[model samples]
Target: MVTKTSADVVIVGTGVVGVVIAEQMLDAGHSVLMIEAGPRVSRAEVVENWRNSPLGVKGDTSVAYPSRPWAPHPMGGEKPEDAYLQFSGPDAYDQTFIRYAGGSTWHWAGTSWRLTPEDMRINSLYGVGRDWAFDYETLEPYYVRTEHKLGICGPADRTQQWPQTGTRSAPYPMPALPFSPGEVKFTEVVKTLGYNNIPVAQARNSGMPYDGRPACCGNNNCVPVCPVAAKYDAETALHRLEKKGATLLVDSVVYKVETSAQNKIEAVHFYDQHKQSHRISGKLFVLACNGLENPKLLLMSTDDRNPNGIANSSDQVGRNMMDHPARSFTVTTKEPFWSGIGPVVNSGIMETSQGSFRSEHAGAYFRYNNFARNRFVTFAALKKGLVGKALDEEIRRMTACTADIVAAHEILADPNNRLTLSDKKDWLGLPKPSIHYDVGDYVRKCWEVYSQPIGKQIAEAMGATDIKISPKFNNSKHIMGGTIMGKDASNSVVDVDCRAHDHENLFIPGGGAMAAGACGNSTITMVALALKAGDAMVDQMRGA
Candidate 1:
């Protein structure tokens, strides 16, 4: 095997979490080497691929980046027979993450949200899921740093801002983007029902450019691929890291993380595109490879001392898998709302996400989906055998009046919903990730008792004629809680600083290190955790 000993810090996964840490490490004058499993593709190539894709697969964001033979990820449209993740539970844990240079941020919705104090202390306050090792106050500064780094845009008004409890230390870098006509009308209609629809804080430019990237031009293609660099994808940070003198290895699938007799990570071994093995040594190693892959890599790297896994002393490396279990409904309104003008999702209902009721049932966040309905409506119209003027009229009517609302509920940490290495192997002969997931009764009750009723009321208040709610629960793709953090090392994989409890030199900072999956999007929180971990890593290296 080829060996290289050049990096001070080695990070697995070139996603946002990994790149964020790399940026901090490189800024502190430490040499960083990032290993990415997937191939690198330019923005032009991804946009061209999206444009050439079939209309049926346009909504599937993963269609822009097809999975490679060696480093596979979940695909949209027609799923391959030999998919990587094997799901065995009531609900399918079909996560859609690209194992590429920029990672899954390529198709992210760009929604940036900070967790409320209550969200972090659910176990202490509500006696539900496990509380974070530290409070939100400790992580607030990191949240501000993340917002500035990502160039987030949001409302400056205290009432309109999320949490609305004076948690923000600084105003958003940019003002909130103007709401689309559909969002404005939905806000007005929801007000009649005493429900507030607030503008979502998103990682996109509002009016003026802040970072090296340009302002958002409202192409309404935030998902799949943003043609312009307005959205904050890891590729932007990866470029910054490269310019700051960091090494990036693409198409390098890290299969094993080697540990010394002292239980500290020595090097990580990866397979190149040619399936040739190579090892890279570093002073500090980080596994930012998302929730699933991080634990899978650890479990796969079993040695004589740690027979279970590298950091599986507590047997919690791949336990307590959680995600935002969601349900959606479609409604046809009497008045035209015109949802095709701006970003796909501009606003959401956040007030419902926290309450004393969470102790009894799960709390949920609601989004007014603003995706253009022309493609979906046209397909329906054609299937109905409409000809000429009738088809055109139907399409226009449906496009103008249809509204799709989705409610994503917060799931408590359940150790039973876990990720394990499957007996089935991939093309590279590595074991595929096997997940057994159940949305749990809390989320199920939230859908039946709380979210469903509120959703019906909002639809009716908006003059909806026909409202159809989905019966089954679906995943929101916000993966969390695989490698959870807690004060006790026996029940947790990482500590308050996101450093692995078993290995001091190894850090696992991402959604995988999250203790609680709050109702809102978890990307911002993940970034905050990474920032905190980066600071700790810098200090540790300095002390060494």
Candidate 2:
């Protein structure tokens, strides 16, 4: 077995959240080592991997992991699959980020949404879902810090979250994306309805330098890497940590996190590409491999100490699976605006987004900060710069276009839903994660209430002859709630600070620990929570 020098802190993943935490440690003068299971990749490869999926479509995972493109094939692929769970059942999917250096942010849409205040008090407000141990006010300051640090673009809607965020110190790093024709039409309808649509809050650089990444250049290849580096990447922060002298271990697959009898981490054991094994001890070990892998790693670390699984005191390591159930609707218009291609929309409805079954008669409710309004057809008009057939004829009409309003459904985890490890193991001899989650009945009710009306509004707004909701077959890219957090250890695996309630030295940051899913998108809130963790951990390290 090979041995490595020790680090003050050893981070198991180099995804956006892990990199963010590493940078925070470096900023605080702590030695850190970030280990990524995936091989190194460049920005061009990040975009090129998508190959030719079409311009305005969602992300394609065909070329994503050439190794284990599909799961049950053993996680012997790009990122460490042994670390993440792959579900197979009524709903089968491998909900994960990229295996390369940046994790999933390599292809994010760059849309950033602040979670609402009600998100924290799920138990109190919804009466059915669990409430966060801490409220939004505790996380408010971190939200502002993340905005400035990550360079967000938005109108700064503080009142919308009902006491979540406040006016910021610095404005957006770049100007908002120019409005297209669809946006104008949508805004008019929203105004006529006596509703105010807030400007979109996104992480894409409009045109200026924010944290050194270039501005958005209309590459339109966001699901892949941005050729111009317009979107935010955790690698940028990873490099900052490296520049500050932190160590990084790419292509290292850690198998188990060993522990001492005293309940402290003994050492982390891993292997390299050559099948060579090694071990490294740490004063503190953070498993920021993201939500799926965090608990998976914990379960794999069973040894002499606490063998019901590490911190299995509650046996809740990999329970409570939740995610945003997407329900999108399409509408065409007589008046065309820049389709949902470029960013920036005049208005979005965040009201009545987060509530309870008593209010919406669903398991829970979620609101979409719909960024794509009439904008949907703006680019459809471009038609790859061709004017012909149905698309061109529509564009040539010089009159209007189509619009799609996607309302994401929020599904709270039933005690039954979760990612449990399978008897089958990966290339590393570690058991692979088994996923078992599906949209429940109450969640469908929530979608019926939230999506049906939104579709009607779009059809009426655009004068569409008819509107149909995008088939339920189209699920979502947003995933949440595998390693859920809560006040009680019996109900949760981690706390708001993201420290695993089972292990003080271990923290799982990312979409995995969400106690409750947000009405809007979750990436921005994930970053904010990461920044919050960075600050919270420093004092803990100092023994404060």
Candidate 3:
């Protein structure tokens, strides 16, 4: 056991949120300490791991970056009990997240979509879900800050923006990447149905470089790992943060948060890789862990002062869980639409996500998945036991003709869709996270009444020879709404700035604080919230 020197701020989980906050604190001349539950590995190592992995495991996003037993996270195809996250629900919340120094962004597709103003006020306008404590206008500047920080590339034209109705304070940091042949075809075909496939804002360097990273080489392996450092992952900022004088402790799993008088966070207790416990006190604490992990950590840190858990007086720490429940349509187009030319996701039908029909059912955003089809088609050809030239021909034909359209529907926050501490324990004897999820009728209505009908139209318009829609909904893995934010303290875990209502010095930002799960990737919003909380932390440290 050891007691380390105190810092002005201590943040748990060195994901994008934690890194953003640490950088902000350093800029403000505040001493910062960041603790991560996973080991630090080089990009080359991850790329090599992906290369050496078997073809069957290549699709599993977490396969390349192996997990440490002490700090377990959900792997691709682990058994129910063996999995880090246990589940008991109609829908399986089998999310994939890495407990690494850079966090899950390492395996993400880097889609950065901003939520429209209507997205934040869904409850008031559509009579569904909880409205954000603040409006989109209040968070717009922070959105710009996050976009610039991440070097987001998007179209300069307002018409090509994800939500045409939303206003922007400034244009994206970089111009949008050109659509691949498949994406261009998808965009044109969808247009025949009065649907617009707008370019998606993404956190990747374009032709010109802004950040230290180079421009995208278009390898099309953005999911497992980008071979080149073109995409903006949290790991890309780690070196910059260390240069800024912020202390980052990798493999330091924070298990408990100690609170002092007035329910203020005094220090956090963590275990290193050796399982040796250590304590580091700080003026303020930020838990930027993902949606599932944040709630589990709070629930595990109960004490005499906090009978339920620290900063969980509202009993909403692990409740009101939400995510984008998605259904996919796979079709073989009449003409060859070669994918795998650029990023895995470049353009999407975002306009479909908004409409007055949202009052009756959740709206959905449709994306033409741009993943290379060779690997997928190869497996299918082998399953048929085709030999030599026959297999090669089948593989090539399937790769050229196949396409996938994903319909990610917005889901409302439901207390029943919850995350709780599990009875099962991990290698470190820590309680695992257990989840209960049901996409609910709102999303179901979208699939049956809204998304499926439009999907049929898209397939028919594309002159598809064969089409198949997935029967069940799958998670987009955009977890949100555990430590939900609101104006009232009783019903919410955090305030507008992501500060805990029960603890003044404690901040719980990121996806956990998102009040609504809009039909888009939630990383940008999470990072924006971190920036918002960062400003609040600076103000508090300055005695504002």
Candidate 4:
């Protein structure tokens, strides 16, 4: 039997964007219901899972939260046919994310960065890639709200900010986290080359607590579940949303977005863990699913009126996929610049991400990974065929000497890098997501001509004895551009406020709606879009 329910506003995800929007709607005196495809587990349970896991898989982000059979997310090293996301192309879009209640933020690096004015208008200024429908000034206020909502801590000084734009309306909610010894050394060395290594604006507390959550205690475990509630993941806001009178339905895989004859979304249908169907109707529909899943569900819900898909009138529902393609340099330095002193990532070089050269090649930002190296170095030391004390000493020496610097490059929005429905089906008989990707000439040119040379110079400045640069590009998992936003309705899926062009009351926000991807973490921008969409939804409700 299919159960039916109703709410003033129905949300299809429980990630950071979803929860943020839900809270906004509830505050506006509207009834909201949020649906999550994955199961909900406590922080203690995830910590235990990570602790008891085999030493070999400790670093795997998905190891802490195993996916449900129905809501399968990709694992680290699965084969093509066995993987949840079927991938193909010159470059592998092997995006890593967990489909738990909190979504991928459960294991994210917690770096929160805002796009500069130049980033949003790349097409106009640089003649490459699509420009955002609106400018950064329109989105700046939302970014400030997002920072406060997530308790983002960053350097208060404008010079230390990521963009160095000197246009921020407000300071960070909390002061920045101090850099580790390795970061300080990297900053000093990079400065000699006329590059600035600035502190990253991250979604975690510092010094004292801001929200109900406590301040970060330097666990050095930002990913794979922060044991303490210091870090701001979507799961941390779940309880607060419930207390504000919003309904959260877990283990509910939303498979369909039902629409009326006029192309307005009326309800959404989902399948529960038992494969039982349920339908929830609402005046306004918000799809807060990720870049991949949002298009998958829309395409799956096609009817006679919408022969293409719910918001596929432009035939651009699943096109223009984008993410930061990264290359790294791992070197053994002369001195012991201990890196595992605080969060996994604390500082980055942001000035390099902006230049007139963007007209030809993409821009990139560099960061020295602050992850603890002991676990990464232990196995290599044992492989040397040494006994107890010798192996221990070797591990200590390598751990202290090793350093990793990564250059994450921005990519142009190529319509060919697309996501589509796969032939493979999950346990609930729903089609899996298949993405085809090529990092494209824009990013490759930047690496060969720009970022790589800078990386080599930085490595040499660090007094590296051994330098190894990655030969191929890897996905940063900051997915964007599937449901692209634009001014013209003929070629884009969503409008400036992320409202669907085909459906009046349907809004699809988050990473999927991003027009241009800067070389920074996109989560803050995604949440800002959610806040913008929430305002639109509130206005629509009032007009109704």
> On a 0 to 100 scale, what is the lDDT of residue 423 in model 2?
86
Identify the superior model by lDDT, candidate 1 or candidate 4: 4
Q: What TM-score does structure 4 among the candidates reach?
A: 0.98
Can you write out model 1's per-residue Cα lDDT over 420-480, one digit (the tens) per residue?
Answer: 9999898788999999999999888888899999999998988999998877887888989
The alpha-carbon deviation from the true structure for residue 469 of candidate 2, after best TM-score superposition, in angstroms, is 2.0
Candidate 4 residues 1-544, lDDT tens each?
1123788888898899898999999999998888899999999999999988887888787888888998998876677898999888899888877777888888888999899999999999999999999988899999999999999999988778866673699999899999988899989999999998989999989989878889888899998778897889999999988888888899999999998978799899999999999999988889987878899998898998899888998888888989999999998888887878899999999889999999999999999999889877788888999998988888888998988899999998888998889999989999998889999999989998999999999999999999998889988889898899997999999998899999999999999999998899999999999999999989888994
| Clash totals for all candidate models | 0, 15, 0, 0
lDDT of 2 by residue, 1-544 (tens): 1125577778888877887778888778788877777676665564565554443442344354333322122222335334445666566444545566667676566667666676667667766667766777777777777767777676534453232343344455555665445665666676575544445666777767678788776555554455677777676666677678778887777778887767877678777766677887876677777666776777777877677677667777777766666666555556554453554222355544644542444422222222333234447567557645866575544334455666666666565776777886666666777877767765667666655675577567666654667666244556567677777888777787877776787777777677777556677777777877777788888998
lDDT for model 4, please.
0.90
Q: lDDT tens string, model 3, 231-342?
A: 9999999999888888888888889999996789999999888899999899989998778889999999999999899889999989988889999989988788888899
Each model's lDDT comes to 0.88, 0.64, 0.90, 0.90
